[model samples]
Target: MPSREVHTATITSDGTGFYITEPVFYAEPNYEKVNYNNYGMAFRIQAPPGAYSVYVKTTSDAADTIVSVSGMETSRLLRGGSWDAAKLVPKKYIATARGKEWTYTYVNGRDYLDIEIEPNKINTPVGVEEIVLQPIPPQQREDGSLPTIFILGDSTVKSYTFDETPMSGWGQVIDAMFNPDKVNVINYSMGGRSFKNAYTEGRFNDILMSGSIGDYVFIQFGHNDESTDEFRRFGRGSTESMYETYIKEIYLPAIRERGMIPVLITPMSRVRGNAAPGYVYTNSFINRKFPDIMKRSAEESGVTLIDLNSESVKFYNEIGVEATTAVVMSIEAGETPGKTNSGSYANGHPSKKIDGTHYKEALAKQFARIIVTELVKKVKAGDSTAAAIASYLKADVRVAALSGDWSKIFPEMAGDTTTGEGAYYRNQIEKLIQLGVMSKDPLGNFNPDEEMTVGEFIRCISKLMNLEKSTFADYPNGELSREIMGAILVDAYHAKFTSKPKYMTDYNGTAVVPGDPDYDPYMDPGSRGAMYYPLVSWQQLMDTAQIAPHLASKVKEAYELGLIRSEKGIARGQMVNGTELEPKVAVTREKAAKALYFMWVLQQAVKAENDVSSLK
Candidate 1:
């Protein structure tokens, strides 16, 4: 199908008078029937002061080529292409303000205009208008300085003044923080935007043009880009891609274009969950995840990243969760909490609604403080003043003391010390020894630190956990040999305790054959076996069935849950030998904390569904 071609002419105010030009075709036209070679051309002319009749004329155009003139209201049609100059009746088109108004006229063929109209505001049609216009002069400081700062972000930083309220955005707050004589803040931020959409809409271009040299531009986003559309998910890769584009395309270009500096800020933390008086409420809220990624991306991108998330977290922690909640709720309830000026329930969005996600005036001020604090440090260090503005904020360094003692640090591992090589496990081994799940060497010494052999480890875990007796009871009887071990491993595999073997070989120094007398073939021992045991010891396995994975998924789940750490990426298929489980490996407190933490999580999950019926 042939597309319609509409010729458009743009007119703008040039100095005093209006300037009009022909409509230029941006693209070549596709010809069709009716000889629509030229659809038509239209021109925009400045409406003269007061109402004036306007018409168009083409010297050689046929009468069939229609000509029309339209003002702000009425329209007129002309029969002849070229009409007698005196015969045209000019209409009254009142032009007010020093602004240009466009009037369109269709000329079948383009030509220049030399028409004249009466009642000129000024004598020379090309000179300034003589209404003795008093311009509202640009704002000036006592010292006559005009410093500029530009901000780029999503809705949070965009200017949004309430119609009847004095509420403004964080951008406005930021402007207040800086000296107007030294800082002219220009907020290029838009609401409901992401890094990608901002570029698609030419917001970056607008910033570049509006910004001046030495101007600072602060960019904060992440609430929006962390979305999964049809094309991409805001996972690590996609988020990194967008972050890079923001830096290379939007941020860096703006800085280079105006010799300005760009500061990257991680989004402010959302007020999720409840806050206490002396403790900050931190929980597994999903909205909190993306800000960390943004901070990391900013640091990796080498831009000045203001750690707003961490700062907010610190602020929350300092006031105690209850106090924070009181502050938030008080503001939300529209009753001044007498302590903090946190506004009403519109928290997440910029609206007057109290949401946990959005910030109110108080929080915005806090964030501004953080920005300025960091900004000033950079500035004092002889960095760009643009960067200094963000450093002007004062960081809230006071935080409440953490409750509880060091004992709570490893609450989950409080009672379990039997798996890794240590004296406590030695006593526990005796209990297992009596159960026949484990045995000491003939030398009268229980090598408590040795790495367990592949065969021995499997047999012990299987028997101690009753895995073999219950599930593989009908299996071929053997001396708990490699073949039986292989069968048990298969059961474990199916149960998802471990991943499938990646290699295949036999103990006889030969790859397993399907059918051979020497084929130790029930399982492939050559594969890289499970790297870490899910539980540190069989005691843990028996004590907490909640930690158990299906025999197939156990090892994988354990590794994933941080129950076990892999050595050289390989979970050796060896019995628990004393020499391998070295107690002097310098286990840090954090590692113990992780183990205990997961144990707590497991216990909580179990307790949450106490009854067997509930479990079902």
Candidate 2:
């Protein structure tokens, strides 16, 4: 299908990609006009009437940057959806926050797809490169056969792009929990708004009219609700108190009268304590008021209640604070990576200061899981209030997996590979998806079996190395020999470390193969197969001809990596089992993705460790 974009500094965003400022300002730029603020750059697109996968390419990179897009809603603090769906992981890791990562998220709404990039902290710039909005004709559903789950909340429940890491909200991943064929989750939250902001603005009344009987509205607040600050406070009357005011007076009544369901979720906890074993709770005021009011309101208002406030605290305290920083915003001066191509990040945006309250995809997914579990519980108990939306939860492997263990980052497989068959790399596949390396294809499918060409592998590795440019895409596309893959990989790694990695034929090899479940070292005794080939070939009554000694090391390394079984059988996505691998065979996309993502993560972790060590 055809696609278009609207660049900043241009009129009618006739679909341009990037500009120095937000769409409302200086219709053009000469580099001197840009400011270093979070909302300085924005993308405005008129997405065609169909389902589409939206991607935002930014010039700036924050570890936990937030990619938010919507229509008909001003920016509130509440976020939506699951962490898995938060497309905020980096295409490459930089020692600094100026690293640019692309965000790929689902697009289904009115014609306008208003996408904005916000740094983890305010006043930080979200540099722009280009915005690609392509409409996928295959997934369009005009018949309204799919139910829509509308989320209304603060920054904690907002839809954040996972490309930025921990900035994602629970509402963002809700859509992934349910089958899209049955429902569409639309997050209409701004990161900072509270009930007072939402209620006073008539947001509930607005939703009441457009929503029908089958639709469900999830309302969560309190993180920003208890603010004594005048600009951020809301819903403060007696009968019109924080949690009670809106749901009792407006939401519950209207939604029920309109034949719909209104589910009330308490706010998730803030990582308000030090990363110690027994940290103090500085956010006690909110913990006390918001949840109490929410529960009371749910009881009095007769709405279904999902107590996330209590659950979040329990989970938070259990994991402790030090680890919480990875989920929230807590990068120290020397701990953060890179100092190049970044200015504002150097000055302290996303510093150890502001990330205390805002959380990311991992936290968001947990919160969503809690909410789904609570909803399912009530629905199963036959709560009249929740009966309307009970069908929204699934009873299949997806739900079972999520409910059974919240630690599993990726949801159950959606399309294929549901059965526990030859999917040894299943865990790796999910990790790749969670890391934003395995996004849905342009046609909106994650076809794991698609053939991965040599060019594609190089491009994938290039992006992982943050060396992606027009050059990598220019590589030849075809099945690659084992030696060729290793040679290309070693070259890239060699350039980064300035240490010439011995060629595949030079060093023993890297990955684990069949005979060597423990990566038993292989030595070239003058010639690789001059001895073994004769014995094996004579025993099997086959030709004594073996893999060329020069190329055989490639086979050996491939074997150790579980890439090949024989001298020519090229295996793709096998685990480190003592099994034979195929050689010189084409690799599948899943296999290629697993390999590149695993290596990238491994290398990045090592780099971060080294960076930390240098500071000490």
Tell me, by lDDT, which candidate is best. Answer: 2
Q: Residue by residue across 1-616, what tens digits does model 2's lDDT show?
A: 0011324453223243343333232212333221122344355677543334455566556453555544212222223322222332111211112356444333232345566655544434445566677654332234657766778887777664312322457776666667666677777665666765554333543454445565778888776656553222122222225356445644565566555567888877677524444564433543337678778878876777888878777766655544454455542211111121111111122232545676544456566777777766776688865655556555462455436654343443323432222232343354455555455555434567777767767766666666644434434677764445554554455445453222112212233322535632443212222111111111221221344455555444433332222322221111111222333456776656545543443344221211010111
- Candidate 1 regions exceeding 4 Å error are 1-145, 163-168, 230-238, 273-279, 282-301, 326-354, 379-616
* Model 1 RMSD in angstroms: 24.9
Q: Taking the tens digit of each residue's C-alpha lDDT, what string does model 1 give over 393-481?
A: 22221110022121221111122222222322222233344345555455444554444444454555555444554565444443332
Q: Which stretches of candidate 2 lie over 4 Å from their true place?
A: 1-144, 161-165, 229-242, 278-283, 286-288, 332-351, 384-388, 397-403, 406-616
lDDT of 1 at 186: 65
Best by TM-score: 2
lDDT of candidate model 1 versus the reference: 0.37
